[model samples]
Target: MGALLRGLVGLILSSVLVTSALAATAPVGGYTVVKAYPHDTAAFTEGLFYRDGFIFESTGLKGRSFIRKWNLETGVSEQERIVDSRYFGEGVVDWKNRLYALTWTDEIGIIYDIDSFERIGEFSYPGEGWALTRDDKRIMMSDGTSFIRFLDPETLKETGRIEVTDHGVPVRNLNELEWVKGELLANVWQTTRIARIDIKTGNVVGWIELAGLLKDAGVTGTQDDVLNGIAYDAVSDRLFVTGKLWPKLYEIKLAPAN
Candidate 1:
């Protein structure tokens, strides 16, 4: 009887250690809306970023996909450029005075003059383009899969990639991306949570739960109106988010999970 009890205790200790290890791998987070600004309800926002006091956005849907520069306070477009009808826009980012826009399933991306919104050129890639973001040197892209690809800023060619994993499991369906403070923040498609990824290791270190953000703004749209779009203003240290067809853009501040 004494030996049996000792074995049971050892088993229980092993279970506890396993549970604690899993908990340590997955960190959770939340957010509070600091402010809300009106957004165009017609926009199917796929990519968003802040620069030079303007919110640069790319809206999707074939024949409706376009890029625009928006006024941050009023959500009004100061400049716009319509994409070709044959392409479906996916994501966009700005680098070195140029704006790059990606197309879903088209295997192509567009480059434009940031100030003039004029199409400068186009580049080709291999897979579907789900989202785009950039750090100082490399452009990062997602393809609705578990992988994030790093591309050359000047040549717009694939340089490297990493498969995103959460606690030894692959995390797929990675959507809109934004590089924030050395971490890659991604909106997983069809979910209310955002994954905060370690760029070097490709591990999901934390998740930012954004539940009820759109609903609180009275956005009761369909599944197509799911959460998307993340824009970070490095200068002001402000983070902004919006959804497809959402009427309000929220400025959020992160709160650590309990």
Candidate 2:
């Protein structure tokens, strides 16, 4: 009888330890806004990236979709390409001196010359294009689902994919992706939190909470105004974030949450 009781206790302790370990590995990180920059309030920002002191952004809206290169300091578009009025633009990324821009619901992506903003080529995919980013070898794409697809940058052909999860549960509505260091940082639609995902495993290793970032920046808007853009400057190690229809952009530093 005593042996049976000891075995039961041991099982319970092991279960508890496993649960605690999982919780410890999945941390919710906080952010401190280091600076605020002017962003075009009329722009419904869908994708953003930093390169060579310029911010390349994609805006979405049926007739207003555009790919723009903005001066980081002044928020002025140095070059812009307005897409066809019938197509809605989505996410964008820079690879091999070319800018790739996706179109929502159209299943088409356009590639442009980074310097001249001229259309060089375009590719067709299967589903909606919600977000885009790239690593050293492959381009990462999302379609408002839990899955992230890997594509060959040269061919724009899907090479592989993985379903993203948080603590073994699927994470949907993944949007606005940026490759930071080695991890893929994705904005969760309709929420202020960004998921830090493992590109190889598709597991969310951590969450960056931007809960009060907009409010602290004195941004006022309706519920439709959700956080949606992420840009990282690898050279400076600076992180920038903004939202749909947001008036300001913020440069933030992440810290471990208590």
lDDT of each: 0.92, 0.90
RMSD of 1: 4.9
195-242 in candidate 1: lDDT tens per residue?
A: 999989999999998887967867654578889999999999999999
TM-score for candidate 1: 0.90
Predicted candidate 2 versus true structure: per-residue lDDT over 1-258, tens digit per residue? 999999999999999877865565467899888998989887889999998999999999999989989988898889999988988999999997899999999999999999988999999999899999998899999999999999999899999999988777788999999999899999999888899998789989999988787776566434657899999999999999999888789999999864
How close is each model in CA RMSD to the real structure? 4.9, 5.0
TM-score per model over all chains: 0.90, 0.88
On lDDT, the candidate that comes out on top is: 1
Pairs that collide, model 2:
none
Worst-scoring 10-residue span by lDDT in model 1: 214-223
